[model samples]
Target: MPKSKRNKQVTLSKTTKKGRGHKELIINGIRDAAEKYSSIYVFNFQNMRNSKLKEFREQLQSSSKFFLGSNKVMQVAIGRSSSDEIKPNLHKVSKLLRGDAGMIFTNLSKEEVERLFNEFEGYDFARTGSIATEKVELKEGPLEQFTHDMEPFLRRQGMPVRLNKGVVELVSDFVVCEEGKPLSPEASRILRLMGNMMATFRLNLVCRWGSEDDFELYIDGPGDSDVE
Candidate 1:
């Protein structure tokens, strides 16, 4: 089967309804991170890769920390209002905790942090429900990429393929995937077999806060415009 976002495991700490203590642990961790680091940022995480995120965390372990959990729990930890605020003006940071978001705390300078985020993005094969950035149409011809024995497998994926003289051949021009439409399970597999990569995974900055400054929103994102 083709890998897809549907199978991606999110890192946000999950807990049972009775495990409220887990929520408390996340809250305390967020508070500690806020106090320990000089600069704090809230980021919107969409279809973030778990393995790449682990690599990213390990790469920045010397000077940065990332915390992701339930949005409501984080909001409570940071304080959505002035009454239970964790730090001075932390409520500003809390406001950006909407959607699938997380916090990144770092001692690095703003310039260096921006550079790190820009350089740290990773790419992966587009999966099911992912849109094709470009059109991939295979003309009627021999497809030596597949072995002769794999003829049945190729045909099962909706390809009009046949083994001719121990070579897979497309009987007609096959539109594997069209631009801007969701790639089907079979199409995703075909795209990867054809070496087409369309998904660029990267984080987006929602807001940043510092001890001396107020939280601010950034529309530019984490410097990855190739993402859908």
Candidate 2:
């Protein structure tokens, strides 16, 4: 009988997993960008929104490059110690990639970068677990903003709402969310329905490194501390 190959097992030893390949790409990219751009900045973000980030990246694509991925991989790309650093004092910048952070390699001046970072802010709807920025209350009256068909949906979200003659009515005063408190899932949904946005996405420069030996820390930036 001919040799059967149907049950043969194939070895994956020569195959690289997608994740590992991606990490390698990121590492190589950072290293290349390091050599291309004169300045590198470590930045941390809050309330991240991918759409806004994509837009921001597009705007700076001509003069800068951004690297965001596994912190460990990024650390390795720039080196984690004085001995292994790809550039002088880059190990210090690696230490700043501890949390929700990334790096930007840019040819722009410090003033220009600072102004851009300070001015760039993206706002969107608040999600559950986010702190409510302000109290949102619905008074006991017809909610003209919502249609009558949304009464059931509103009620399901814990809103004291009902259909009153083809209109959505609040049966009683409803406190959707309180300022300074963590927003609940119900509250988040209600806020979305009411077109309320409470989340602000912004980036803060943690540190900056020059191609040579120059390095500086932004004391007011996020993750400001001694290099680990």
Candidate 3:
């Protein structure tokens, strides 16, 4: 064979080997995730810039119980597995896979995972594109209406609402979800409140786990006479 032809064959072989290695790594990651975690959250982030993506990844790592590999590789590994328990959740997750996607696996229950997500809610201030479920944007109409309705509800919870240049703001720290935009001062307070409430609920559930007291707490709110 000519020298050029020989070189081409070697390059193709190397490329094929690299692809196989990557697939193996993905399969391994999925197996590990399944073995270690009872719950998984698959997030699809689209059009995120490099810097923002890095920040998001770092945030997830710090907050999540465990963050795993890409969806494509994990899907293949999951497909081969015999576990039916996570299968349903994984199938539902499959639908969310689009653009640049990632998975978070955790031994923590669904409620716990949700609490983590809520905790990390507003860490990234800038709009780094959007998730498939909620698109972030800046506008005037519905967001204003939402802010109006939310203000009273927030105050009832012992939180205050402030207005910044015609925009409603939360006086106390809270988690604010408007049309998906994360606005500071006003909106940040709302989001903080919501996140705190979710954390409280999760803590209550965890405290009452595996007892008749827990059952009563679940059926009715805390302070049930039978619980104690």
The prediction achieving the highest TM-score against the true structure is 2
Candidates 1 and 2 compared: the better one by TM-score is 2
RMSD (Cα, Å) for all candidates, in order, is 9.7, 5.1, 15.9
Q: At residue 222, what lDDT does model 3 achieve?
A: 37
Ranking by TM-score: 2, 1, 3
| lDDT at 168, model 3 | 62
Candidate 1: the clashing residue pairs are: none
List TM-score per model, in order: 0.85, 0.89, 0.37
After superposing all C-alphas onto the true structure, candidate 1 shows an RMSD in angstroms of 9.7
- On a 0 to 100 scale, what is the lDDT of residue 68 in model 2? 86
Stretch of 10 with least lDDT, candidate 2:
219-228
Per-residue C-alpha lDDT of model 2 across residues 95-168, encoded as one tens digit per residue: 88877999999999999999999999999999999999899888999999998788888888988887878988
Q: What would the per-residue lDDT of candidate 3 be over residues 1-228, giving only the tens digit for each residue?
A: 546654463333433344878879767766676666555555543233455445545765644433335556566665523253235334334434334556665555567555644454222333222211233223332235345546566555444555566666644443233344544454444444433221111111111121112211222423333222
